[model samples]
Target: MPPGTPFTVVYELDDECALELANKTVHGVCHLGWVPAADGDYELRMAVLVKPNGFLGRLYMAGIKPFRYGLVYPAMTRQWESRWRNRNRSGGARPR
Candidate 1:
């Protein structure tokens, strides 16, 4: 997970199958969460609190939003899906 910069694991609960990461960057702090979906799949959600230093920070966030969602996240999901399918086929062993 390209979890932005300066992130730490804020909370995790394997029993609940949930995890959260808080990222503090120059522009703002973003809290990202991972939770199991109804069908046993996982999903990622994010909440952003922007305290932009100036106009630049706001602009930066706006500029990156499309790139992150349109490109980065889709690619990451594909890779993750591939790995997951491969791992399952291999009986939980990671392929080298």
Candidate 2:
């Protein structure tokens, strides 16, 4: 992403990464993690943490709750799964 994008990389490691975003209404972190599975594969996990700036921020979060749960999260999961599948097909090594 460009320098001015809302999200900024906080840290990245072999199994996890975090990005932060702050705006007038809210501040948030998006974390993506990978864990070894019992089946000898990796599982992807994601979490979002947010702090509301004030009333507007609280309202904004509430307003987007449905879309976030119903659309955004599912879409993101699909994209990640696709990338993982493609990587395996191409014999790409997992990020470390």
Candidate 3:
């Protein structure tokens, strides 16, 4: 997450971070976690929880579902992956 994004960081820890967003249409929280793998590596996991404000809100969420899945999420994943790859080169700088 960047400075100008709509989401506000609720909390962050070594292995997890939670970001929240609220608007007329919905309130949502996005959680990112790093899970330990059996092979002694870590995998990134994401979960989003949303609450619709009303009928219109529900409709809005439904409408954006396709875009979110087809475009937004994939792009975000790529960006994160790139960041992760460059982290060591950058002296392990934390993601902002």
TM-score of each: 0.42, 0.75, 0.78
Off by over 4 Å in 2: 1-5, 80-96
Looking at model 2, residue 78 earns an lDDT score of 67
Candidate 1 error regions (>4 Å): 1-5, 15-51, 76-96
Considering every candidate listed, which one attains the maximal TM-score?
Answer: 3
lDDT tens per residue, model 1, 1-96? 334634444553322112233334343444444457788766555555555456676677678889877886577556644544455576663322
From the highest lDDT down, the ranking of the candidates is 3, 2, 1
**Per-residue alpha-carbon lDDT of model 2 for 1-96, expressed as tens digits?**
235657788996656778898999999998877777789877778898999999999999999999999998788766765665466567765754
Looking at model 1, report the run of 10 residues with the lowest lDDT sum.
14-23
Q: What is the lDDT of residue 74 in candidate 2?
A: 80
Model 3 per-residue lDDT tens digits across residues 12-94: 76567888999999999988877776887666677889999999999999999999889987787677556664665868644
Candidate 1's TM-score: 0.42
When 1 and 3 are scored with TM-score, the better candidate is 3
Clashes of each: 0, 0, 0
TM-score of 3: 0.78
